[model samples]
Target chain A: MPLGLNFTQIFLHLFNFLLLFAILYFLLYKPVKNFMVHRQEVYRKEAEETSQNLEKSEKARAEYEEKLAQADREIAGLKAKSGEEAQAHYDRQVKAAKDEAEKILRDAREEAERQKAAIVQEAQKDISDLVTDAAEKLALHQSSQENFEKFLDTVEAGRAEAKN
Target chain B: MSKKQQRKMTVIFVVIGVLLLAGIFLTAGASAQEEDIVTVIRDAVIHDTNKIALFGLEVNPGLISGLAVTGILTVFALIVRIFVIPKFTLVPGRFQMILETMVGYFSGLAEDSSPHKNRLLSAYIFAAGLYIFTGTMLELFGIQVVTTAGHSVALPAPLSDINGAIMMGCTSYLFIVVGGILNNGLGGVKGALKEFSLPISMSFRLFGALVSGAIVTELVYYYTALSYVVPVLVGVLFTCLHALIQAYVLTMLVALFYGEVSEPSEKKLRKLAAKAQKTEVRTAEAA
Candidate 1:
């Protein structure tokens, strides 16, 4: 055969090469490729799950922070409102106490003045009675012994009347 | 010139002068009896056909060499499949890294050339690349076998036989045709048919490159004077270059042509245009 070119050799070479190709395809290429693809998919799935979990936690944290901030605002507002109410209540109570104290002092002063006036009227009446007695004694000096006895009897009757 | 350059030039000239003198002496010392150049050429070109009678059928020696290569490849593949591949981890070992790099290189070539048909094409290219690379480099081992005629001969690269190259070329063409049909239907068939000369060109290219290297190496060895240093240089350079370049060339051609033929045609364009129109209408309505 010129340069080893023959139908038989060509056909056999073709057959041998094809057989090798088939063996390699089945043995080496398929399995390694499948393994790589499967590993890639697994890694992708894991990454996705991790990312999703992170996002969920972030959202939950944000919601919690919002609620906490809202709570703080409400507590502050309530504190201010309550503080105003307490101050108003304190002012009203103080004003009421002051007015009541003033009323009590005025009533006490009036009662004390009435008692003083009554005492003074009684003293004046007593002073007028004593003065009349003194004048009667001076005018009765004509009958010495008889005038003295009459004055004594008159003093005793006045005392008895004052006592009654 | 600098001192260093002047010194380098002087050394180069001295080496050349010595080589020329040695050449003249060697030629003068050669025997007067001349060898037949035509006989040497014939011996270089022709491989002995040692036929095996398999069920009353004749088998060629080239085929025998092809079978040996195939057998070696099969056993290697089987070993890797059972022992090496199974033990492969996410972090590759040295041997595994070499295998992965080889597979990855061809796979990347397929993907870059034909993204749509990357799956099928990559597998095919990987198989083809391995076959060519291993088949060519197998000759470097210089394994010889005794034929039925009691004549011992060194096995040649499978592609050194024109039949093997033709087979590979035709097979690659078949893949390209199938890829086209699958991707673009009738248009793909027409496209593939237009490139009918592809198989012929591919076969001749592979066969010619490999045979030329063998012929040159044989010619170098045939000469007594030149055989010592020249055969080593020629054989190594030619074998390595052919093995690598032919493997890359065939795979690249297959991928490039497959990609060209398999690209989607009128129907895909229509679908794209329709989708764009629908989007436009929706946007207008929203506005």
Candidate 2:
């Protein structure tokens, strides 16, 4: 009694404490802690899910960006290729037109040369025939009017042959 | 002034003057009628007189207060478990915030002290801290019960009793020792045994600290003219301070000791983990 030390009271206190402990463990501590744990788990899962979604979107965006870049590069290559092809086609068409024009001019010049040669040969032949006829009329000593008339006829015939 | 108004004014003045005079006389009379300093100190230290007999053993008011603390805590827990717990949201409300702060503090303490295994330890400290805090705060209510001997007794903090303090100390020591033995075998027991004075020191610490605060509060109430207001402050603050300090000290000591003893044996830890994994696999297969 000096220090209020009693075995029975000590046991009662222990019992009372134990009872409170049990009650709190079951009713208060467990459930509240469980709720807190559950909430933490939920938030963690949500955070993880959000992170995964972000990662997926990031990957998709990167892939799309890569595809876009590739497409741009391909389009640039196609444009250059097409432009070169068009240039080549235009050069070919110009060359072909020039060759065709040179061919037409050369053909016209060749035909004119041939015609000049033919006219020259005919004039020479006519001149030769006229000279021969003049000599023969002088050697025969005929009248001057008759010789001149034959010369005129032979010159007219040669002129007509040259015209033809 | 009218005669009626004049009469009312005179009456009000007389009443105010009489109340002032009465207040002075009451304070003076209260200071004059003082009890013995030694007896007050003795009563503060030990409340063994007029003990109640339960199971043929005389029990102190501290024990009764202990019972009351337990009952009150049980009811509060039951209420929180039923009503408040169900309504708890991820984003906490006011009451939830308060509860979380209290519980989280103890849990964090447990985690700091016993890093290896803290779930059970946290629960333990939470219970112990709650009991101590609630028991010490019980005196604030000034709950009184009349005994068969025709004397009214005011219940006080449970640990004010030497027996109750001894109980707390021994319980905590036993808990730590048991934890050590269960976790680390004979080595933990040896470690626990080395701290043989822990129970006695813890018991006296709780008892002395609480008794000293009570004594000073009683001394202030007895010796001072301003006992009415001053003692209220001293009693409340001292009691409250002691409640928080003692609860923290006991739970902290237990956590430290339990943690030291209950650290898993290093050499056997791998084997235990492997065994646990095997069992888990077996269970999964069985399921």
Best by DockQ: 2
Q: What is candidate 1's CAPRI-style docking category based on DockQ?
A: acceptable
Instruction: Return the top candidate by TM-score.
Output: 2
lDDT of 1 by residue, B1-287 (tens): 99999999999999977886687577755744233556544533555444444546565445566788788889988999999888888777898878878878888898899887688898889988888888888777777765565655566677776767778888889889999999888899999999999999998898888778767765665565765556567877778888999999999999999998988787876997899999999999999
**After aligning candidate 2 to the native by TM-score, how far in Å is the CA of A36 from where it should be?**
1.2
Error of 1 at B26 (Å): 12
lDDT of 1 at A36: 72
lDDT of 2 by residue, B1-287 (tens): 99999999999999976876677566775544333678657756776445665666667878888888888888898889888988999999999999888888888898899898788788888988998888888877778875445566567688888888888889889988988888888988998999999999988998888777666765775654545456568778878888999999999999999999888877768989999999999999999
Q: lDDT by residue for model 2 over A12-120, one digit each (tens)?
A: 8889888878887788888878887898899999999999999999999999999999999999999999999999999999999999988988887887777776766
List clashing residue pairs in candidate 2: none
Write the residue-wise lDDT of candidate 1 on A40-109 in tens digits.
7888998999999999999999999999999999999999999999999999999999989888888888
Candidate 1 segments whose C-alpha is farther than 4 A from its true place: A1-4, A71-164, B1-40, B43-61, B147-151, B223-232, B268-287
Deviation in Å, model 1, residue B118 alpha carbon:
3.8
